[model samples]
Target: MVNGPAGRPARSLTQTLPDGVRRTTLPSGLRVITEAIPTTRSAALGVWVGIGSRDEAPAMSGASHFLEHLLFKGTHKRTALQISAEIEAVGGETNAFTTKEYTCYYARVLDSDLPLAVDVLVDAVADSILDPADVETERGVILEEIAMHEDEPGDEVHDVFAEAIYGNHPLGRLISGTPESVTPMTRTQINNFYRKRYKAPEIVIAAAGNLDHATVVRLVRKALAGTPLDTGAAGPAQPRAGDKRVRVQKPHTVVLHRDTEQAHIVLGGVGLSRYDDRRFALGVLNNILGGGMSSRLFQEIREKRGLAYSVYSYAAQYADSGLFGVYAGCAPGKAGEVLDLIRQELERVASSGITAEELVRGKGMVKGSYVLGLEDTGSRMSRLAKSELLHGHLMSVDELLGRVDAVTIADVEKVAGDLLAHRHSLAVVGPFDEGAFPPG
Candidate 1:
């Protein structure tokens, strides 16, 4: 048996995993996790790295995302065009994305083409040349991307909300660095960051659909051979440290003026971490409030009052911090009334808790979405990676559904009171000055 995080014994190789799922840890400390779905013709694979925007220093802001773009530029053995041509030759697609806490490069291809997918992806990630010319090219592209983001206020307000909560913390910074930060960044700096941070122990390779776990492991090992990732024996990296509390700024209002047709507002505050036992309860609460058309926020804000065309509630959880927010897009003139209505509903839920009937519907919504989301290979592959990389273990679909089913009305009330009753920070974007919305 191998040691797991915190020096505990992990599941032995002989131990039974969830149905059709298997895992192996290489001597280099990289993990390969897979789920076999015999009925599908296509397979999905992802290389998940533990590092993300939150891992970068203020000066290195957006390094993770910048590196993501650079990796596709070329590698030691394959030209950029050759890389795309090889994948496209097989009618496959590939892409990568950066999140606050991790980054993933993935591809979906026919099961027979998984070997090609594995080789090309691993080569790009492990042996990228980081050409100086490519860096300058992507820098300009990223700057233009940042400029374009400002044109969409509905999307920009969420980032503004995060900033309102975390202030200058790394978590608050944009995943794509600002023009000021990207323009001056050097290729040498990026190359150094990539070599130092992308270690074997902090990476997980996951694949799903119409494949064998053993074969996937073999492919990964072959693909990694002689690359920077092929290191001497080690154990998988310990999960991110979650014992320390993440400090958040005091609740306040932050507004960005934009001459837009609609106002976008996000109101919320600090919430339970992903590790909290109360997260299941919080999930149920979120669904009951605004998960679907039948949700309370949709009914009250849009159906009953016709105050907004779009309204919803969401919770974002990280290793040691989280936030729960309600979002609405409406006419600029109706911003104040919409905000008040959101506040009133939050107060009511926190005070009286959800009823038994609401609790049942909420649980159903949570379970349904979770199951329906996994119907595709990409989602299944992601689930395997997230469980291993983020949560430290794989939880079966049944176990997850059970957790949601176990939430009691009192549990919902407890999480509601703990999260919603706190002072909230507001972020608004559209036709308004900074002081348009006063602090609560």
Candidate 2:
């Protein structure tokens, strides 16, 4: 048996994978997973590291995002301009983003250019210079980004809602971080955080489209040679455990006063974790409640009453905790009415549940979105990486659809009752005082 995290037993490196997909774990503990799609002439490759904003301490809040920018600035092998110019010369694209749980640097190019993409991305991620000058420049850019984010009330309300739910928890903090955190964070702090946290065992390399899995693995191995990721033997890190519960603050109303044209509001509460079996049921409920224009919220708030231009329900799941929220952007005068209607509908669904027709329609929406999203190489590559990095196993597309199809009306009702039972926290961003919204 291979050594896992903390000396626990881990899966063998040569386990069987689904059709068109393959996985290999290197002696250095880096994982390479791939999907071969012969019909397309393009390929998408992603280097996914299992570290993000949530992994940071308060002093190092934006370090993950800052490191993302610095990685692209320059590596020992290539300058920043050469990095972009090389990819663009072949009509390809490369970019990276950091989320709450992980950071991904990806490139999409013709299948013939896969080698170039692999070399560039791996070199950048595994051997960045992290120059002090580049760090200072990125610091200014990140501060401006934080300011620009505050200007968008539609977006800011979601952050407010998260803050209301999680309070001072890491999940509630901004991914870009605040001006205070970004300005004071020194290069040494960030570099130390990067070297300490970005472990080979905690990384996954995924590629898809018109390629052979063996060839992709070979390319990645060659690219990683002599890099920081090339190290002693170890098994891949295990996925984050789900048993540890996240501590949350009590529900309350939080209003950010901004003189905006539309009032942005979110009403929500605690939700199911990603590992929960009832998540399938929650997915169905979300689609029915606000998945599309045909959803209950859209039909009631926008089409029927003309109360809001946008209204939707969303669910976000993490390893141990999650959030369920309903967002509506409406005129300031109509905010109260819109919020009451949302509460009424939620209560109605909770008490009575949805009908048979709604259940079928919800299931169809979930299945169609999942399948259609995989039509491109990027999504497929992302699926491979996320399954390995986040879930620790890749469920076949058919298996996922089957799981959704098995959800019955009873399952939906049970989840709805459980999720909606708690008092919802409110977050409002508009021209309003702190007490404009009542306490939950």
Question: Compared with the true structure, what per-residue lDDT tens digits does model 2 show for residues 205-289?
Answer: 9999999887888898899888888877777888878899888988899999999999999999999898999999999999999
Candidate 2 stretches greater than 4 Å from native = 1-15
lDDT of each: 0.91, 0.92
Model 1 lDDT tens row, 127-166: 9999999999999989898999999898999999999999
TM-score of 2: 0.97
Clash pairs, candidate 1, are none
**Considering every candidate listed, which one attains the maximal lDDT?**
2
Worst 10-residue lDDT window for candidate 1 reads: 7-16
Overall local distance difference test of candidate 2: 0.92
